[model samples]
Structures are given as structure tokens and as C-alpha cells.
Target: MKLPPWFRRRRVGVAATLVSVAALTAVMAPLQDDIGLLNEGLLLLLLTLVISGTWGREVGIFAAVTSNLALNFFFVEPLHTLTVQSPENVLALFVFLGVSIIGSSLLAAARASAEEARRREAETQVLLSLSRAMIGQTEPAEALASLCREVVAAFDAPGASVLTAAAGGWGVLAHAGSADAGRPADAQERTMAEQAASSGQITRIGHTGLGNSRRPRIVAPSGTQRIREADVGSAFVPLLFGDRTLGVLRLDGPIGATPFAQHPDSLLAAFAGEAALGVQRAELAQAASHADALRQADEMKTALMTSISHDLKTPLAGIKTAVSSLIDTSVEWSDEDREAFLATIDSQADRLNRVISDILDLNRIESGVIAPARRSVHVASLLDDVRERTALVTKPRVVTLDAGADIYAQADETLMAQALVNLIENAAKYSAAGAPIHLAASAAGASVEIVVSDEGPGIAARDLPHVFERFYRAQEGSRRVKGSGLGLAIVKGFVTLSGGSVRVESAPSGTRFVIQLPVAEQAKASA
Candidate 1:
């Protein structure tokens, strides 16, 4: 038959004590005439101390009583009887009993202290492992999944899941262990979870009758309530960060079996709280990243509008003035004057067209649609074409080119010439009327280098970095000179597309813009 736990626990100690008492009494009974009662009592007392030190206080007490009874019955004056015939023998038996009880109590207390220390150490290790797993996890869902796995392993449960607060209701973020672990909590289960979350408390619902029914109940802090043992399916631990409840950790196993039932409610609740802080931190980081992206986009939009308004108005104003002068009938102009005015109209119209074209080209380049058609092109010939096209703007300003007849680069000829034209135009707009603009090209290693230098006031140091940005005009130079600010930007975009690079160097002496493109295979073979 199955015995109660109390009896079962002491069974081995009881048996051992009984056997020791019987043996000691049997051996000492033959020597009782030679040895005194006090000597026999001392031998029995030593046996009682050994039992108490090994089997704990309850069993120790049982051993002491057994030893005392044996001493009185077998060793005292009334030999083999349950009575002490002499008063001095009675006092000696009582003294042996008292010493055994005192020694057992001390031994039992020491054992309890060691056991408590070991339990605390195990709990500390579990918590440390959990903290390590959660560190550096940026995603909230990923962090929650790690926490669930750690909890399941720590408690030796079948499965564990975390339910986070979602838009409509609770959403399962992560689960570990069994396949069914991640399933959405049922209505009743969710109710229990919500109760724990709302109240910032831990709620356990399972068959609690199997364990200690009368064990000391765990009381929660103010604003929290302790969970009592009840017939339910699982335990709901609320993940709380201060007054805010982030989510709930739902732990469960097979039917009629609660694996986490053995764990203390307070410890599980504390673990859930740490997991909540991790989730909160991850969510905050994500929100911050999103906000930064939005801010940058808004700033870009504002800059685009401001640039478009300023650049578009300059050419439009010129065209409007020229057209208005031509249509005026109040003053009749001579043939020469009419031709000059017509020329002004044509040139201003062309400038407006170029502005619109630059806008379209920039849009295509920024959207990754510009694909250069590269081929071997003579660098001298390309410079000649650009110089001719920019004759109208460079007439007053002297422009000179020094490039070898055979210098060739692998690039889109049309885009390459356009880039050179933009650079020359920018130089002309900034340099004095009589100042010289120098264009030089030569083969350097496997690449051809083209340099456009102008005798103009140097660009400011702070403006150099942003010189190639779209719609970026130099604060110092833009005020004195008129431009759409798209020249340098277009040059950079076209050169980059042709598998080339462009850079600028500005000093007190002058500003130099450099362009480098790979030498063509045919050109290298020819050389």
C-alpha cells in the first residue's frame, strides 16, 4: 500500500535507527554486568547523533526517541523492561535523550541553509542566461521568441508563447517547443491573459491539487494580486514595464499536466517583466528610425521647390522682356536694331530650352534611367566640338585648349562633350571678361585626364563638398553670377554614367575641375 509522504520520507531513517538500537542493546546486554548503565547510554547516544545528522530533524527526533527507549529497556537497572529501576539511571537516560535532540536540530538547520543557497544559485544562473539571450536583439518579435525559448528551458515546460498587444487585440509574436505552442490563445485563455496584463499580475490556471495544497500562498505587491491554485489549463504571466504592461507570456503543456506549476509565481513574473523591457526598447528604436527617414524626405522636398522656383524665373524673365520690346509699336526700329533685338529673343529662348532639358535630364539620372552608350572617342576632337558650341558664351572670355591629337577615352561622345561644355560655361560665367580659361587633356596610365582650370576667384572651402549636389549654388559666387546651378550637377551625373569620375580642386590661385575616363582598348593598341 502507498504510504503518506511524511511516513515515506522517514521510512529509511526509521528502519536504520531501529536496527542500530536493536544491535547496540543486544551486544551491550551481555556486558551489562561489567559495563555501567551510563557507559551503555553514551554508546546509544552516539548512534542517535549520526542518524539525526544524515536524515534531518524529524527523522533525527525519531532516532533519538528510539535510542532512549532501547537504553531504558535493555541497559538500565530494570534490564529488558521499559522502566528505569534506579533514579540515577532515569536521570542518565533523560540526559542522553536531551543531548541527541539538541545535536539533531543543529545538523538539520545546517542542511536547510545549504539547500537554500543551492536553490538561489540555480535561480541566478537561469536569470543570467535569460538576460544574455535578450541582449542586442533589435527586433521586438525576435527578442520575444528568444525569451519564450529561455523560459521553456528554464522551467522544463512542454511549450511557451508570448502574446503582444496588437491593433485589434492580442497577437502571438513568438513561441517555442511544441508545434501547437504558437497557436492563438482561445477566448477563455485570452481572458485570463488580459486579466493578468491589465492588472499587472501573474495568473496561473491549472490543476493545483497535485502539489502542496496547504503550502504558504505567495502574496503580490500593492496593486497586484496573488494567484491561488485552481483547476485550469495554463499560466498567464504579464510582461510589465513599470505601470505599462507590454504583453503576456502564456505557458502550457499537455492536458491535466502543468509543467510550470512547480515554479514560484513571483520568479516567473519577474522574468516576464524583463522580457517586456526588451520589447519596449526594440519598438522605440524602430519608431526612431522611421521618424528619421521621414524627416530627410521632407527636407528634400522643401529644397527641390525652392531651387525650381529660382532657376525657372531667371530665363523666363529674359524671354518676357525681349518679347515685350519687339511687340512695342510706339517706337519703330531700324533693320540693325531689329536684328539685334531678334537675336536677343532667340538666345534667351534657347537658354530657357536648355534649363527645361537640364531639369528632365536630372530627373532621369536620379531615377537610375541614364545608361551611357560608350565608345572610343578622340579627346581633342571632343574638346573642339564643345569649344565651338560654347562660342557664344566664351567670346569675350579667352578659352584655350591643349590636348594631343591622338588622346582617346572610352565614353559616350555626346555626354562627354556636354560635360566639357558645362564646365567651360561655368568657368566663363565666373571668370573676368579678359581672363583665360585653360582646357588640357592627356593620357595618364590606363586613364585619360581632362582638366578645366579658370583664373577666377576660388570657391569657398565649405561650399566644395556640396558643389555637385543638384540645385546647389555657391553662397559667395551665386550672388555675383547668374546660373541655374545645374551645370556641375549635370557634369557629375553624365561622367559617372560613362564609367568615369569627376572632382574639383579650389585654391586662392584658381579653381580646377578634373575628369578621368578609362583609355579605350583600340586607342591603347594604336599607341
Candidate 2:
């Protein structure tokens, strides 16, 4: 709406105040006593000239004319009037008045130009600082907060803060100016800030309500004890990493505080992007390192197990042969002595053979060789065979397989038995030998899952991720139980060759190993 006449007049009065001092100084210039005040007149005139553009060219001209009239009336001899007294007075008056006006205007204009240049420079500096801080930050949090703080300080804003978007809500992270009378932090404000942030909207609140009161955010105050709650102002700059909105930059300050001298909206987005990329990189690196370590450890364990199996078998086989030769058609000592010798040989050979077999079976699986093959075998029947074989290593765990009409998995029966046997053996080795080892199989969708569960101390949390890797005995402490770490690795490789996947889940109760394979077409048809 157009201002009323009175309001227009009032504005004119306000504008007149800008140059009134210059006008008065010029008016006193003609008085001989006021001659010294001419310098004051020049100074005032200069000030007026400097700020002249703020009003307009008309204001500037009025200032110049007023100063000249005052000089002619008050200082040129006959005081309080605009009459020129004599020729010398005329020249002196005109020269003095004209020089002052011209000089003032020129100097003022120059100063004004310099001031403009300085302001532009400050803005450029703000932009540069904002740009670097934003771009350098691959992680958005610290940088965004710093950006707001630095920019506020650079532009002399009151305070700075930032709010970011998070799952289900937002997070408020801010810095304050000096204390003032205001509400202390509370959950209410936090919730509001978070909600606004999640919405990815620029929120602002001022002393006089610049924006919605529900979620007022702006250039908030910096460090201070007492903030006048009424004077609080806030603003939110949404952090956009790409097409997605990553978060928001929420800040607040005292009322009337300005934003960064030159607000660079684009810089905020850049900082968020950097943060996201850094976080992603860190996660990927961790995953890759874990996988690599497991692979190396498994390889080492496989080699060691194979060597041990071979070493043990060689001596055991020789001993067995020598004992047989003693028993069969050879000159012998007393009956008692021969019997004792034979018994000892038999016991030792049996024990050695069991150990050698376990090692060889594990090694063979790791070396990618399937065991002795035979005719069609029932899953239940094969499990029983495996249970018997596993008894030689660690006593049979509570082995169980459904009595269903011999569900068949097409593979070398012996190899399948060996794989299952190894798995059972491993469960016993890792846990107490007598632990209830549960085995279950079921047809789920198109695949069959065979899960072996042992009630032993679950693997260590740190080691759980690598339990399948050979020689990875869940820890680095006293490794009392010795084994070719190849058991699990072999099992894994065998199961994989049979076209399947294996996974281990360990919790406080016990560790569970699950193997899933695509059942043969016939098995699927039955299901």
C-alpha cells in the first residue's frame, strides 16, 4: 500500500537528518567567529557526500546547495543572510564553499567506492572459506557445523548450529553465542528440529516470527548463558548429497543477525556428499579386509592338516605290518610276551589309523577330491555311517536324521557321508564332545537345508565372522584341541562342489551350521 501523506512527510524528515549537520555547518561559515567551523562544515559535507547514494542523487544535490547557502549567509561578512558583501569576500566565500563541497563530494565518493570494494572482498572471502570447508569434508556432520560456525563468525552473525536428517527423524547439533534469557534445551525443540530436518526444509524463526513457529530454525546464537527466548532466530539449510537429501543444516542466532555475507547454497550440498562417500569407503574396506584374512588362514590350515595326516599314517601302517609278520609264521618268544606285544601293536595301530583317516578325509575334501563312491544311498542311512566314522575322532554327537523313506541327494554317497561326518566331527571338536549336536533337514521352497547345531560355547563375537576359515579356532588363546583346521574348510568345499552354500551362526547358546543345496529333480518333484 502507498504510504499516507504524513508518513511520506515523516520519511522526508528522516532523510533530511542525514545532511542537516552539513547544512548547519555551511550556514555558520559566513560568521567571522564561525570561520573555523568551516572545517567542520567540510567534514560534515564530506560525510553527507559519502552516504549520499543511500538516499538518491537529489539528496546529494540538496546537501551541496544547503552548504553553499550557509557559507554565503553566515561567514561571508554580513551574517545570518545570503548577501555577498564585497569582491574579496565573494571570491573567498565562493572559493572556500565551492572547494569544500567539491572536495567533500569527491572524497566521499572515493571512500564510498573503497567501502564497496571492501565489502565485495569480504563476501569473496566468505565464499572461499565456505567452499573449502564444504568440499574438504567427506563426512558431513563436523564440516556442516563448522561451516555454519565459521560463516557466522566471518559475517559476524550471532550464533550457528546444524540439524541433520536421520532414519525416522532428525538430529540437532548447534553452537550458541553468549548467554541470554531464553529457554534451555529441551526435548520439544529437539523433536521439532529433527522433524524439520527430516523433511529437508529450510526452517527459520526470528524474534518477531520470521517463519513458522512450529519449527523455527535460523542463524541461532552462539555461546551464551542467557538468551532472550523471544530474540532467538534459526535457519535450516538442507544438505543434499545428490538427488537424495542427506540432511539439513540448522542454525540459530539473535534476532536481526545476518547470514554469511554471501550465502553459498551450493556449498552445503558438496559437504554432505563428501561425508557420505567417506563413510561408504570405510565400510567397504572393512568388509574386504575380513574376507581376505579368512581366505589366507583357511589356506594355511588345509596345508597343515594334509601334512599331519600323511605323517601319522606312515608310522601306523608300518607298525601294523611288522606286528602281522610277528604273528604269522615267524619265530616267537614266550606266549605271554607275544600276546602282550601283539595286543599293544593292535591297539596302537587302531588308534593311529583312526587319527590318520580323519586327517586324510579332511585333507581330501580340502584338496577337492570326493571320497569313495557307491550305489544309491539313503540320506538317513548315510548319516548313520557318518556318525560311526566320526566316532573315531570325537565320539558321535547327538546325530539325528529324519526316518523319511530315505530322501536321496544325488552325489557320490561316500563323499556325502564324509562331508557330513566332518561337520559332526568339527562340532564336537569346537565344543564339548558330549554336547547335544542337533541335525535337521527340510525341504524349503526348491532347496533342502541341512543344519547341524551343537550346544557348545558359541564362537567369540570377533571370531564368528571367520569360523568357517581353516585354522580359525574362534580365538588366539591356548589352542588345547589340535586338529587339521581343514575339517570345516573341507566340508565347505565339498558342500559347495555338490552345488550348495554353507553358513555358520553362533550365539551364546551354541553355534549352528546350515547347509543348503538344490535338491535333485526327483526330490523336488516329491516335495
Candidate 3:
């Protein structure tokens, strides 16, 4: 059996110390006549010193008293009696008693101090390890589990658990070791933990009796209770932070076990303090994360309002002005003037339709309704289709495409084509009038790469990372672009859903958007 920590090392029990003294007396009694009286006194004193050094001061004192009486009755002048008959013997006895008691006291005190220092050092190490483990832990359940593991390892207990008060009452947040070890084995343990948390004091529950008669009982503290032998079965330490009792840390040991039979209040406090901090950190992190989410939602709402007010209103105003002019008959208008007015109405109406379409696409993407029907799509044909569709948007600007007839990509052709159209339109809108917009497709390893590049003023370095984020637009020179910032975001969503990835590279001279899609089997086989 493993000895209790207090009894291990150089310490022994009272019963063992007495038995040792008796054994020494038995061996020395028969040699009383052969040994000198003073010499006998010295041998007994030597035994007192040895016992005191090993078994501690209290046991040493008891040993000294017992030995002095034994020496007088068994070997002193007055054999088998308490009376001393010689002056020299009386003086020797007094000196021996004084020396034994004083020497033992000093030696025991020194040993106790050394043990305290070692205990403090070990506790410090445990606290340091626990603090490091808990640092930067944002998840509440994960933090609690880490604390439980640390407690079990530090005490060598059968198990440890952390409990917190939730809406549904007390719940075990996390546990380590034996499943039942941390749970309340009986109602008494539950009561003990409740008492600890309510009072912010350490409480304990203990088991006593034998066989089927064994029962658990509350051993809660009137004040702060340290880990005593009777309180070792289970300990409920309140996790207190400031004025709040955040939770309880329960430590469990097997009945009759000695590994955790004795522990100091300071050591328990250190662990509880760290546990409280971990819980508080997790709570704060959760609050911060929730607050951030709400803030982002508010920002998105504001951006949407701004887009509607500027982009939608601008197109509507142009259409309304052109229609009102066409209906007025007070002036005889030329055919040229009427034609210009009709053209303005048509272009502005198209612009309004495009904006509404972009908004609907963004909604679908965000709502997770964009599921692509994957198929082998010829790259050359997809590029040609996109170029034709965006001819109006890229008017007056030269557009170029480079794709081999054998190149094909695994993607939904309609989604991929729409994604490319957005890129081409975006390039044309930002670049100088007539600046060439180039589209290319090539086989790269196991994927097909589609590139759209423009000799436009490239995106600012600070804006490149967030370009694909919905409702985000980089300022063009001193003014923001007049459109919903959903084009690039839709492009990304569609490409991602089609089993492809998109990225952009920009410099002061130009900008390049690259999309990579899985290469179709036909393309690989044909190559």
C-alpha cells in the first residue's frame, strides 16, 4: 500500500515509534550489567535523536519521556521503581531529558521548514503549468476540461471535474479520469458541493463504514477547510473571482487512498484561482465574439442602404428625366433629339435592371441557394459566350480571348459564364476607355486556369484582401465607384460553388483576376 504523503519520506506513526522504543529496551536490558551506567544513558540518548530526526518532534518528545522512565525503572539505581537513589544518576537523568527534548525540537523544526519550502516550490510549478494551459483558451468547455485535467494530474486523484451554474441548474462542464469519480455518488456529495459554491468555501464529503454499510456524509467547513484525512474522499473547492462564485472544482480520490489525504489550503486556493480565471476568460471571449457579430451585421445593413440610395437612384433619375422629356410636346423636337432621348431611356433602364439582378444574386449566394450543376464545359466556347454577353458593358474597349480548343473545365457552364461576365464588366468599368480587356484559358497541371486582366488603375494594396467580401468597394481616386459592390462577391460565390478558386493580383500598371477549375477527363485524355 502507498503511504500517505505525511507519513512517507522521513516520518513514521506514533504506534511505530513506541514499538521501536520497546524493542530497543528489550535488547539493552540484559546487557545492563556489562555496560556502564553513563554509557547506557548515551545509547538511549542516541535512540532519542534518531527517532526525533525520522518521526518528527512530537514523536521524539514521547520517545524521550518513555525512554527516561524506562532507563530509571530498568537500569537506574532504583530498578523496577520510579525513585532515584544516587545523586549522579539524578543529575544524568535530568541532563539526558533536557538534551533529548531540546535537540529533537530543533531538528524537527528544521526538517519541517525544509518540507514547507519543497511543498511551496511544487505548488508554484503546478500553478504555473495550469496558468499556461488556460491562457488564450477561448472555448468554455475546452477551458474547463483543461482545468480538470490539470487538477487530476497535480493531486494524483482518481478524477476531477468543474461544474457551473447554468440556466437549467448545475451542470458538469467538464471532467477527467473515472466517469463516476467526479459525479456525486450520493445526495450528500451534491449537498457538499452546493454548500461550497453558495458559501464560497471549500467543502468535503467523506465515506465511512464497511461493506454495504458504507455511506457518504457531508464534511463541509464552518470556515475554510483544508484537505484533512477525513475530508480526502471528495473535495469541493469554490471557484471565486472577485465577489462572484463562478463555479466549483471537485476533486475525487478512491476511498482509503492516501495520495490526496492531506493538502494545504494555499495549494487548493491557487488551483481554484486559476480555474476562476479560465472561466472568466471564456465568458469574456464569448461576449466579445457576439458583440463583433452584431457590429458586422449593422455595418452590412448600412452599406446596403448606401448602395440603394446612390446606385439605384442614379439610374432611376436618368430614366425618369428621359421619359418626361419624350412626353413633352410643347417644342417641335428633331428626330435626332428624340432618338437621343430614347437611347438614354433604354441604357438607363438596362443599368437599373443590372443593379437589381446583382442584388438578387448576392441574396441567393448569401442564403446558400447557389448549387452548381457540374459538367465538362469547353473553355473556348464559355469565353466566347461571356464576351458576347458583355459587349455592351465593355463597349468602346477592345476585348481579347486566348483559349485552346482542347481545354475544358469541370464546372457549371452557366455559373462559370456569369462569373466571367462580372469580371469583364468590372475590368471595363474601372479601366480607361478603350483599354484592352484580356481573357485567357490554359491547362495548368490538373486544373484549367481562366485569367481576366485589365490595364486599369489597379486596386489599392489596402483593398486587395477584402475585394471579394460582399458590399465592400475600394475608392477609385477620390470617389467610390457608383455600383453595388456585389459583383466580385457573386463572382467568388459562383466560382467556389462550381468547384473552383479565384484570386487577384494587382499593381499600379494593371490588375489580373485568376480562376482555377478542375480539368475535365476529356481534356486530360485528349492531351
Tens-place lDDT digits, model 1, residues 423-453: 9989888778889889999998899999999
- Cα RMSD (angstroms) for every candidate in the order listed: 10.3, 16.0, 7.5
Tens-place lDDT per residue, model 3, 82-153, is 999999899989998999899889888987787677677877887788878877776877877887887777
- Model 2 weakest lDDT span, ten residues long: 255-264
Error of 2 at 293 (Å): 9.5
**Residue 379, candidate 3: how far off, in angstroms?**
2.5
What TM-score, over all chains together, does every model reach?
Answer: 0.60, 0.38, 0.69
lDDT for model 3, on a 0 to 1 scale? Answer: 0.79
Question: Which of candidates 2 and 3 is the stronger one according to lDDT?
Answer: 3
- Model 2 C-alpha RMSD to native: 16.0
lDDT of 2 by residue, 43-162 (tens): 546645643444334455555666566656555557677887778767765665566556555665765576567655765676677667667665444554556555455535465544
User: What are the clashing pairs of model 1?
Assistant: none
